[model samples]
Target: MSVNAQPCPGPQPDALVRVDEGAIWRADGKPFDPLQVAHTRHALSAHPLLQLPRLRRLALSLAGTSHVKYALPNRKAGSAFHTFSESEAKMSIASTFDHIEEAGNWVALYFLEDEPEYGALLRDTLDGMKAQIEPRDPGMHGYSLFMFIASPPTVTPFHIDRENNFNVQVMGRKHLRVWQAHDRVAVPDAAIEDYFVHDTLRSLHYHEELDARALDFDIGPGEGVYIPSTAGHYVTTEEGAWALPGGRVSVSLAMTYFTTQTARRARVHLLNAFLRDRFAAAPMPPGKSGLVDHLKQPLAKILIESRMRLYGQAAPRGMSGH
Candidate 1:
């Protein structure tokens, strides 16, 4: 019901990304082209948000806090996974504000216009809905949604995402040094399966130490980093800050974008929904309707996994390193 958007579609997919740039992030890092990448880092000095400790705290709480996962593209996983040890399928973070509704998966109904967080997130979602250079409705894209999870000290047991994402850090800090995706890594379907079944980090074998596409520095407040769609990456939080007497937390923003393929996928899904309601609904009996699921669920998984392994690592989609 946000006036910001002409109409609302879908539900409960409330935790993937924000669309705009922090001016400085773009100014400093290089990757401006849509196809190529641009990765950058910032120290506490680079961010302005730190001046407001309350907001900083809120951001930290959002990160350290966990949420529910939604149905991710097929990576040989279960129906749904949780966010904190959480859900992955259409993941949702607990929103105190009603606008950021939580139907639990793929259904983040935003209450933007009223709530600041949801509103900010919704606007970001709209920005990424379609490329500014391209001509297409916002609905034309298949997007991803993920809320950054912070684990102090330990290596982020690697994984990939359901869609392309730019994991930008807003507060605290963590290092996720990753390798480009390669076919050489041998990850058993079982390991991916285990991730789904247990909603835990998938087990993978990187014959070599993880690749150093870049050694991700601890992204301090207001700082963010870019990533490719469904690209795999991981992180390790610094010990100093979190180890401080009272300790600080890490909260990063995930910017999920819609790719050409995902846009088409979304379009197909929408058309299927329309047809099902208009033509198929009356004719088909209950429980027999396939609608878009028959195509979407499988395609989602395939695409997610494919993107993750594209550079050739061959590991499960969500585990680190693309």
Candidate 2:
């Protein structure tokens, strides 16, 4: 079967996003919503565990499990997508937010593990949302909930994520700018290869002109955006928009789904990456042949596993950031 390419018109929607006949349409008049977008953004801040005091304590307590990133807004003009400058002041995780806020900088804490206090709530929220959207088989999909706390006026930078994400804006407001996943002009093919195979940085090279092709949304408290896997996007907080009376904070949850399709795509990319990076062979486009994917997957797995084993043997005993 031969596939013909056609030029499609831009989106023209009144709502940021609209669902009709089980299809979600974007502002640009594109039928782009595949992950089933549904969000109740308002109730996020009201969650008992997300309050500043509680979250601060949680950040401090889960010291080892969490990763803190300091945003350097001035570095945006540079080639690097995100540059993190170490905090000059020695502050604890609990005090990091305050320090960042005071310095007119922003710090983001990523909580990957599900804590006992809020794990159930996160699970329930995701479960409820999943019920309203697509019918996903539990066995075929994996779930993870990441809660982020960022200071005001910080830019998260342009990047593509591996998993389908439900970006729940619980507190504060943000400008979410998303570009089409398969748009080669926005996200380069090599970047996609590096992302899947090497687990390299997901940051994309931002271009001012590409903004014209993007779908921009100003999401406030009680709103959510469905970000499909490999869709390049950047998020920046609105200054003091979501701040409470005392201080500034933007709280959000990134609920991710790793489906069977995700795995297959990863494998396909990994195989292509292996061929291109190792043998200097031109990479083939995905979804062309099932037999090719089936053959490439096991070879990719073996190569990856062998690399891991070799690296494990060569590394020093105590170093452990895998």
Candidate 3:
């Protein structure tokens, strides 16, 4: 999709945040509480991604043009729903990635790595996170950052992400229902394999029975929620509630980190998939085999690098992004 690449019309300050084991703190060195977020929406509006000038330009950049995905409103009335045909959904524009919406329940996912300012911002932000996250793994790991902007009352279908995500809410309010990362019932092994290895869509199926076990909460501006890798969750943007005058415009930043532990686990999944699919072997859980884990990690790393090289050669020049 696209946005008006106009100059920023507001201030350009970055958030000063620090993360603890279970909570996030702001500049004052205190837990950043969301109890009063409704009153602070406008005051907490300094996110660089939301700055008009930068946002518009970034939205039109290659990242925005190539990796973008859009969905027309799901007009279904019930709470529990499933995939519907395009005819059952609202009339959508062409599948091309060169469109943008100004109103209605619109949504956009901007590939942040394509924007230079965002690339630098992500590096600096991850640098700040080193003290908090580095203890998990001494070796450096690659990361990705994406920005999401949605209009009011939009419901992102339930899904599981492949990497550890720190979701920062830049504007408006959102209610997120998340399940534990290791909950096999909520997330099946096949689903994980499809995402990490097969490059399928990140979304997962939803079951009404799983709702009772979910930990649901509301988040607002200047606040964020940590979503563990492979955790199942869904997002619902509030409808003009605690948002600006027009339809609620919720802007969020998603930081995804691939630590060593993540890499090892991904290797395990890849190995298990090979054994199961090729050799007809029994399923294997991650972190279960020291020998296999040891051998597969470097192998996985090599395979990943080779694939990247092949993809790089085939991809159009200058299309690479984090």
Return the top candidate by lDDT.
2
Residue lDDT tens for model 3, 1-322: 1111212122347642222222232323433221111111122247545654555555555432444545657532223323333334432323221333334444454457556667666666666556555564434345677776666667877777666677776666667777777777887777777667775644356778888777775666656666767787787776655344322567777766666566667666765666667888766667567776777666555555666697753311111222
Q: What C-alpha RMSD separates each model from the true structure? A: 15.5, 9.1, 8.7
Ranked by TM-score, the better of candidates 1 and 2 is: 2
List candidate 2 segments past 4 Å from native.
1-43, 64-66, 73-90, 99-103, 132-141, 240-247, 288-291, 313-322
- The residue-by-residue lDDT of candidate 1 on 8-91, one tens digit each, is 111123322343433223324343433333454333222333222433344334432333222332212212232232243323
Query: Residue 286 in model 3: shift from native, Å?
Result: 1.0
Model 1 TM-score? 0.45
Tens digits of lDDT, candidate 2, 207-255? 7888888777676555667787778888777666545442366677786
Q: Estimate TM-scores for all models.
A: 0.45, 0.73, 0.70
